[model samples]
Target: MIYVILLTTIVLYAVIAIAIHFRKALHNSNSHQINIQIFRTLFLIVSVNIGGYYLNYFQVLIIIPKLGNDIMAIRKWNQIVGILLNVSAASNAPILYFTSTEYRNAFNKEWQTIIKLLSFCEIAAATSIEQI
Candidate 1:
């Protein structure tokens, strides 16, 4: 249990530290579209992770000994971060969509590319049929 807590704390700090460092580097050095998208996505991820941790696990830790979890019968410490991890899972697309213009533009460009390719294939098939 202590090992699990230690590992979780280590991972939490590492993730935040790396994200912060990358964000700073992105701001200081490369401000390109892709870089900005990456930085924004990383920020969103960190927010989600921290939010999830706080929502369930952190409260469990604080409330278990300090106060009490009124609803739950068993106060067995859950090794899993939190139920709100699922919240982060569900929220990725919406968060990215709302947060980053580059993400939306890039998404649109990909669909456009696919449509163009399909159209080209259809045109080629039609020309081959005509020749035959």
Candidate 2:
């Protein structure tokens, strides 16, 4: 099912992220430690949220179908799970943006380069137009 695929993807990402975190932490640098801690907390929160959502999904889709009752309860649980999942998904971007200085700096550098290129292109265009 789709849930299985989503769960698998999340687990894979978590494993890779944890491995990278550990590798960075092994460096024993203070800044790496701080960044690792921040990312660890974020990963924990997101993992819990995703786990709860998947558990609720499994219960609603698999267990409930067999039981063939408690439809209202399943519906309510699904709604709550859906909301939690959405919140977790939405928070991921902001959490990374705020926590990772390297990411922000790289983004800024790329933006500046883009701006410089655009200005150069504009100047080149203007020169060509004048020559014509």
Candidate 3:
């Protein structure tokens, strides 16, 4: 179920990425070329991570069930794959933040707002505490 959904999403993303790549290729613009490269890199990262996750899922659900409790080695492999998958997933955000100008701009704007809100909250709390 979840595996199917993940597979479907990866397929759809690949299709879109390829379409964008071709579209960008036709234009020959420098920024579009850069964007296509970034898209390819992002696609590779996401696909690898998703594939790792699927492999981990298969090991846990299919391999473990058929092999029973005797195989300690498969269990170890499953744990390793799980850790790698998590690390890749964690890295995705930072990669996008650094690579995509739009994401960086949005993140910066949101971060500033968050900081301002936090500072306001702190001031309000301090004034209320002073009244007591």
Most lDDT-accurate candidate: 3
lDDT of 2 by residue, 101-131 (tens): 8767877888899999999999999999999
Please, what are the lDDT tens digits per residue for candidate 3 over residues 10-127? 8988887777766634456787877676786668767767877777777777777776666686677677877877786677666678778887898899999999999999999999
Error of 1 at 126 (Å): 35
Q: What overall lDDT goes with each candidate model?
A: 0.65, 0.72, 0.77
For model 3, state the Cα shift of residue 47 in Å.
2.8
Candidate number with the higher TM-score (1 or 3): 3
lDDT of 1 by residue, 1-132 (tens): 844774585587667656655663444555554555565676676677567755566656665566455435334444244445567656777777777887778878988999999999999999999999
Clashing pairs in 3: none
TM-score to true structure, per model? 0.41, 0.46, 0.68
* Candidates, ranked, TM-score: 3, 2, 1
> CA shift at 22, candidate 2, in angstroms?
7.7
**Could you arrange the candidates by lDDT from highest to lowest?**
3, 2, 1
User: Candidate 2: what lDDT?
Assistant: 0.72
User: RMSD for each model, in Å, please?
Assistant: 9.1, 7.7, 4.1
